[model samples]
Target: MTAVPEERVDRFATARQIADAVLLEGYVLYPYRASAAKNRLRWQFGVLVPPGYGRDAAEHSHQRTECLMEPRRGDRLAVELRFLHARRRTVQRAVGSRAFETVEELALADRVLVPWDEGVEERIELTFPVDELAAGEVVRAVRLAAGEEQETVQEDGRPVGRLLRRHEQVDAVLRLSVQEVPGPYGTLRLTAVVENTSDWRPPAGAGRDAALARSLVSAHLLLGLERGRFLSATDPPEWAREAAAECRNEHTWPVLAGGDGRADVLLSSPIILEDHPQVAPESPGELYDATEIDEILALRTAALTDREKREARGTDPRAGAVIDLADSMPPEVLERLHGAVRALRDVTGAPADPADGQPWWDPGGDPGVDPDRDRVQVGEHSVGAGSRVLLKPGRRRTDAQDLFLHGRTALVEAVLHDVDGSVHLAVTIEGDPGADLWRAQGRFRYFQPDEVEPLEEP
Candidate 1:
């Protein structure tokens, strides 16, 4: 591995914070305990199961990412792969002096232990020069062997029960290859692949759980550049747009993650995210469920009863830490979790002083603006709050999921105008039962004036 500079190391630390959150995104959900139904289906992302065991659509044997980067001579790239190793835990009861029988739960004088699968963190790092990758493919063998662990429980020096944990061996292969992208500029496209080459096969008609035992849970890649700049797979420059579109990414997507608009690092993850994504600085700590609202989870965890909390503590160490954190959080800290006003910007897009420009903050006070009554010209007609329109999202959909709304009828909630003088229509899907809730939350899908067509009166 190349020796990273002090400044580059700091960037790595920043990236690690977000990567850790991704690794544990669905490890546990609200309530932070195993008893929760949602928690039972945890480890939802980046799981690559063994060959014959992964017969279902949810399971897979490999993941790959293709990204573009501009590298000069002597430039180097470092790739770090992170994942979770699942450890199956079980409890046994003492039936005789030297014999024991497997049990579901074990209770001792101090605590009660419940059998649950726990994850241990694993990391693999590799580095290569630009010339080396461009010359030919670089491959590395990734292997973690099968193992078992045990711990004994005793009452007054007499053995009462014991715990057993085990994991299956995993064999994987990591390969990387690069090619110069076609264009007027000197851009290179890098293809990185990770495959579950583990020869382990499950018994006939085995379940998903058996397959997952040999899987790489919550796996992701963090790539760093020494003297080169990587392009964003989500949003590429105009010149590289055609080339970027040609890149083939499978199961995972790469996004710029070096922060502050730096292009020296890329985080290819199974979870879709924008370029330069950051963990909220206001967050209290890692709740292990990034998909859920941190404030809501903390509040719910704080509301758990004493008995419920005890079961949560016994379920897993991470869950216990969550319960402890919620109990120790102060009112002031909770308030911060509510929200933060990062900045105040005027209609012209310049920073505003809350002292005197407070009136501008309220659009209702400004006679020139009225979200409820504002009208914007859409095609040949004008559309307002009470009008209806057909949604036609832009050709370049940043979120592919938005395609589900194409050609759908929507009620216009507002016609908004920004500093650039561009008009947008905020709308909610017609006939949706949750439309009222969405409106109350001020959440609506937005499209440009050209992307909406005024509907005819019925």
Candidate 2:
């Protein structure tokens, strides 16, 4: 094959990060519950089945995951394949009333029950040896399993049926193969194949197939590089890095490469081979659907109650700020604001009405005053100097900073407004390191009016 150009090398690191994000949380989804219908079919990537249908019918099922890897000359690539080997036990019970039925016919005709029996068997976690393969070379590893004997049926501690030994020898086989593809840059392609060489077929179309598929396991490859360096999220190619950075809540971003050129660049994520049309192209690794924002907003509005709103203002800083802003307006103006929120919720299919009979915002007979100059109130407390505030967790935050101060207390030094008429708070923590670090190093954190709560004075 013709070699890919050098400029294309930068994309490899970004692609590896995206693939890793998918691999780490490949089977995990939001509202993680197996009973959820949407979560029933968890495995959506690189699924392979045995030649015959059904779990027990097929002697062996194999799945292969492959990814293109680039390594500099004289560098070794460490490839590791990790996965779970799930062995299901099948129990046979006679359906019809036949005491003297032949063991062969009974075994063939009996209904099979696949259950998770305590102390029955343990799942095997298979991990291949980390193979440091050289560029342009092929490395292959295989594992074979010996099947075990199981009883067909037991009646009152006595064996009523014959002994059935299923797939007596070579029950399963797992293979890992890595081949170095000759290219302009030293490039290697790694492929990991898992074969269910046992004669066990999970029931068809009962979600068991998907469940079994998910049990296959995840894999990661660590490559040592010499001349080439991996790109960081801060570097150029913002398009490649933004998704991984923004969706940190849903996916993990492992340090793919270090600052030094000599360190190993790790692609520690599974390669998803199957296509998922449900996932948006921009955020392929997102656990929740892109439209989940609408659903979440709808749920919030539908469940909005006066008691809940009061409690939110009392406890939640963000909600309190927004509520206080609404509370200062005239009753008719408050009605308009509530109507606007309800209208937005209506567009998103959320219940627009508040739980209380009263409107969302009731100023309680407004006192005539200049509304433009009034200080914003957060739960009966105005945003002013010396006010104790709590930070909101869901506030939009800049990248590269940890959420260390969320829910923590801070004293407001000043309440400032922006050119856009948005409110901001300049605050200082009690034990903050220093003012110099706050200003020069960006250690000082600022909050939007809606991102903080004004606490009642003690």
Candidate 3:
């Protein structure tokens, strides 16, 4: 039996990776986001050229430089390199370490702190494409000077959560400009801007502003930072939830039913409240009070059950309450209807009389009242129950008077035809200019007295 001796072996490659083979031209630069305009740490980068590089590559070179973005914890950092000619812009070749590894792998690789030299003034000017500069988004360029080591190398070989440490401040003056841009949805546009002349400082928490500013210049800068994350758009994401609850409480009774030409508007793509018909009372007054409108729009969107919305064929009684059909009714009318129903309920505190013979206050009245009770009294109003009150057409509502006299439009706006051929309807109308001259409409229906049923609360 022979005893084997224990030995440790480590693998190493003498050949340089293709990415490392590419020479660092001169300097690197990083731009700060436009939102952080007041900060002094806009542009920061370093310059490192290959040992034997000359001026030839700068003037007559086939090389183009590009900035690469990789995701990190909460933000993304700028990376630089030579661009390779490709069929498409996205297919352009990666520069530096990116050439040898996938973006994910490169981001996860061990981080090396960029070294800096303070004695030499490392400054480089960069020009951005005119189209890329806008108001909402700003870009700044940092000048990286060529020099000696700025910071010590990481003692631990492995990459950690916080990779780079700041060493020194590298400030550069910047000139910035911005332009407005149309956004993805509509006439709404965002701004994009480009800035130069920055007083470069290190990122927050970095030990040395100058050293960190210089260290920020490597080809693989921002390697430890996060990718493009949209934080502004989703501020306090839970606010959406709170908004939903408030809408439900406000719109509980006589929920808005759709109107004619309203189906397409309600079901339209993007569902912008501004483009739709003015449906709420607050609308046609203030442009910004779209909260209720948005909530109603959402309810209608969720209520879309039928693939083909039932359009106005003849005169369907339930059509007035239909979600899709309610679009045509002006928001003011709907708001009034809601208010009327709520007011009636509060005033009466009891049910109105039914059209058919039955006790109006009795929930257990005649059988004509619908058991399902999708229809309920907001106050003391009832459609099936006939009202003793006579609603005459108003003086200002010549149209209503004409309709009533001519029998053109029904006095009652909404109706229901029961299985036994009984009719009941609810009504609303544009009021007169004054209270005395106000035009009014009410819900009406004809039902067999023998077949009348008690209406229950929905």
Candidate 4:
């Protein structure tokens, strides 16, 4: 996840923190009520619906991740496939001494019941020697046992309704294999593939709800190495760039993780991430809604009326947890969640303290940099704002639309530097009616230094 491994063990707690965040992402949203429309449309990330079920191209029945790793003799790799199993909770009202009739809601003296979908965490771990994966493909069977449970709903100790909860038997397959290829240097490139092969089919004209019942929700893999190191697939070194590019990943994204930048662990996630991403330290536990900030949601949730709070608590146990967390969190904790900063540095590239100088985000942090007067050297000529250039659209760096700009003249609007130290020239098409407007709005097409040809002065 060598590049990402087995379900998370204690050693991978850091990665597990992020993994848990991903697992519960969007499990529930703000208002946290069953009646809320947003609460019903859930499970957005890493959901693999039953094989061939939905028309949405973005949602798939299976996914694969390919990454590069370097293994030594006797290297052992571990992989943990993590996902959520969805269970249906039906609220039933007692009609007879031994029988109950299904109902929409059940009211008791202390609590209210609403029918909702609940998630059960599922993890399957497999460990193997690197040679074993490379010599022959490894396929592990994934199964979530089908089960049912009944929770008696009582008002003052008298049975009023029953909560019937059950989950479908879901089956899936995890395949791990590898290919050996030569790297840009004398080193070797070990490309690994992780895939999902499930054997579930939806009945005639089934909807997403039906397919999702037997699907793997928020599925991801955590990878670890005992005697090997993994390389960054997204930003490989100059030597391994070509080899890394050769890896074809589908739907899934993998990134280096854990241990002070050591490549021993990788997280192959359905969501895109930079290498070594972590859950924010300021985060106050799971909100189930990743899109919104914790502090804001905390305040809003704490503000809900007593009646609204009751409904939220009854919606799902998770929402109840969120409510409890928000209501009981200390002021110090809430203050910590207000903001966070990372990679702070000045224009001189010197580390700066956020507590001291002007914020790094503000233009006054350092006066050394200015897009308006800054100039970049291109082919013996100094180019800056107002300079002219012809779009060359280099084969290596050009996008699909870049081809249409081929041979077109453009006016440089700014010379920008990215965090990665790459220089890009922002420009607008020459003589376009809206060029001035776009320039005023600071919106323009960007191209690398190599993708443009300097236009000689007339």
Worst lDDT 10-window in candidate 4: 1-10
Cα lDDT of model 3 by residue, 110-148, tens digit: 221111221222223233333343223344544433322
Which model, 3 or 4, shows the larger lDDT?
4
Task: Choose the strongest candidate by TM-score.
Answer: 1
How close is every model to the real structure, measured as TM-score?
Answer: 0.75, 0.31, 0.15, 0.73
When sorted by lDDT, best at the front, the candidate numbers are 1, 4, 2, 3
C-alpha-based local distance difference test score of model 2: 0.41
Q: Evaluated with lDDT, which candidate comes out highest?
A: 1
Please give, for residues 1-458, the per-residue lDDT of candidate 2 as tens digits. 12433433442444344444444342423332222356444444323343333554322255444434454555433333333333333444444553423322222222212221111112222322224443233434333353556654655665555433332122334444556444454444545444544444445454444335323333333333444443332331344343324322111123344322323443433332221112223221233232244234333433545544443342223334433443343445333333222234222333334554533332222332222334667766676766778876444553434267777788776655543456667777756668546645544457777778777663
Q: After superposition, how far is residue 457 of candidate 3 from its true place, in Å?
A: 29
TM-score of 4: 0.73
Reference-based lDDT, each prediction: 0.83, 0.41, 0.25, 0.80
Tell how far residue 169 is off in model 4, in angstroms.
2.1
- Model 3 residue 71 lDDT score: 20
> What's the CA RMSD of model 3 in angstroms?
29.3
Count of clashes in candidate 1: 0
